[model samples]
Target: MNRLVQQMSSTPNRRRRPDPAAGEGSGAARGSNCKNITIMKLPRYGALSTRRDDVAMTTIRVHGWPVSTWTRTAAMTCIEKGAEYELVALDRFSPEHYALHPFGRMPVVEVGGLVLTETPAIACHLDECLGGPALQPEDLPTRTAMRRWMSICADYVFHDVVRAIPRGRPASAEELAVARTALERVESLVGDGPFLAGDGLTLADLFLAPQIANAREKAPEVLDGLGAIAAWAAGIEARESFRRTAYDPASV
Candidate 1:
């Protein structure tokens, strides 16, 4: 997770409930009384899905730089699950930011006192706690496949493919070879199914899409023979969650 600057531990005094009256920044309210916590206003899905009245409404605060793929992944999870959230632009080097996440990485999710450091944990929050459309599959076999793909994404796809493209200039022949192998690996894994986890969208798709997009924009030819992967990426991009979390790279 070099992209995350190597995700490290969160503050030991981590768990915190929202204080409606809390002010801005950790200094205004640290420990158990952090600032900007608000209740969620879950929308009714009519006959298809009812509003979860028993669950406490709260605003999920995602602290991260928008340009980060993982940060966008966290935010997209909120969007897809209909969780009201606020994206707090984070400068990991700041004293306050480092206080929230000791390693100074983006995507420290704060909601109703719960502080989550890892991307998967942040993305799974709503489904696990608030009760909404499941982002993870329930079937054991499919679920196992989903987890497999997610692991591949974190371990190989991002670090191998997306990170291989040189930042300021054209990728060297060796660099493009590495990226091609990574993309081809994904292409071979994605069977005839519409998504990484069979037919449904799951954490597997969410985890892989951003990295794929990054490679496409930077070194497109690495995906030359990967029509299926490109199509899958396009479908993921079409999702409203992806669009909602899209950020201008130059702005970051």
Candidate 2:
């Protein structure tokens, strides 16, 4: 997983400081006691982080509805790793739902007092903790290729398929064209592989599966003739974690 850089920006204070107490002078002595008072406290979800002498088992708080595809992806990672976590379902899909994330989005994961917003980061952290049947490629080149395809899966495959949903049919002509171009690019990157990373299941497979599943259900015609992609999607969907976490409208 790519290490994210945390950047903090400063904003100028708009409020003016009140005049000092006439007798006490600046209220330094009076305000000193206020430091001891705890007004606002951090919200605790459940167990987070890894177990070590220095650190606690960080709580993986999933802040999204159970049915969302992104939430499913993150939850499936936790299941794959056998990591203990808590799911915090949020009703409002507004900016307030993602106060902890840099970009307001669902499925934000809070670990070791640090909030990770994207699915890839959260999945990577979980993979680190559990370390069984690791989801990432070991070599640098394969890892780079996986990350690139994973992004393609996110930005292209998922994007167009999701847009095709509300129409209650296959994607529009323009959307199909876009998906075709993206699929061709993805095929070139992943060429006739049983999985995106060649032989084994990795993050690329996990990320790509749901997008293909969505298209399969809503826009099967768009996916017709994509033999390799279809076979990979079938294998991923057959996994227990995927079956349990992925969206099923009938279950609702």
Candidate 3:
């Protein structure tokens, strides 16, 4: 066994009392149950100065609701990078949330006391900090391509398909048609491989998964004609990260 796991196993388990100051329904509130805590020592990565020792580590705290697609993106990024994190459920309109995110976004990442907002920025920062399999391609052109897809997922696919599928409302025919066109565009961009950018998964896949998952749950027919997208979504959904972070409507 690795030294880290051994140390974790040997350490005495201690119950942590919930901080009353964390507010109701926060991650800290949920963690009030002593049994919920798991002690694992993880190595530090990304943005750490060389001056720090190799064994040094930092905590990653994610504040968001699981139902939010953007929040899922940030949480999945951490999972993909093999970093342990705490999910703190916060009301977006709450003053506490505004303090963390000026724009009142759902996901706000706090790592080692540093706060970061916006899905793309937070995901990219976590990817950099955790230093595992690279989420963003190393080459400039491929990286640019990946970023372009990310933008498309955010600007077009998400707005047209994802947002149009209301929680309890049946999708309108016009809405489905627009969503199909966006899905077709996504299909055309996919190469003959498992992921969107290429053979390996990238930030593009992470960006699209939550939105796609929402579509799959709400309007399966909208994705029927797009074979490439179906296949890509299948592989992405199979990922442990997706399974861990993807939203389940039944649970809501």
Q: Judged by TM-score, which candidate is best?
A: 3
Residue 154 in model 2: lDDT: 63
lDDT of 1 by residue, 130-244 (tens): 5557776664445545656766876788788867886668999999998898888778767555577756888778888888877876777888878878777878899998888
* Clashing pairs in model 1, backbone N/Cα/C closer than 3 A: 16-113, 17-113, 38-59, 39-57, 39-58, 40-57, 40-58
* Candidate 3 C-alpha error for residue 200, in Å: 1.8
TM-score of each: 0.75, 0.69, 0.76
Q: What's the C-alpha lDDT at position 245 in model 2?
A: 70
lDDT string for model 3 (203-224, tens) is: 8888888988888888998888
RMSD of 3: 15.2
Superposition TM-score, candidate 2 onto the true structure = 0.69
Looking at model 1, which ten-residue stretch has the lowest summed lDDT?
Answer: 1-10
Instruction: Give the lDDT of residue 104 in candidate 1.
Output: 79
Off by over 4 Å in 2: 1-59, 164-170, 250-252
Ten-residue region with minimum lDDT total, candidate 3: 22-31
Residue-level error in angstroms, candidate 3, position 244: 1.2
Stretches of model 3 off by over 4 angstroms after superposition? 1-56
Pairs in clash, predicted candidate 2: 47-58, 47-59, 48-57, 48-58, 48-59, 49-57, 49-58
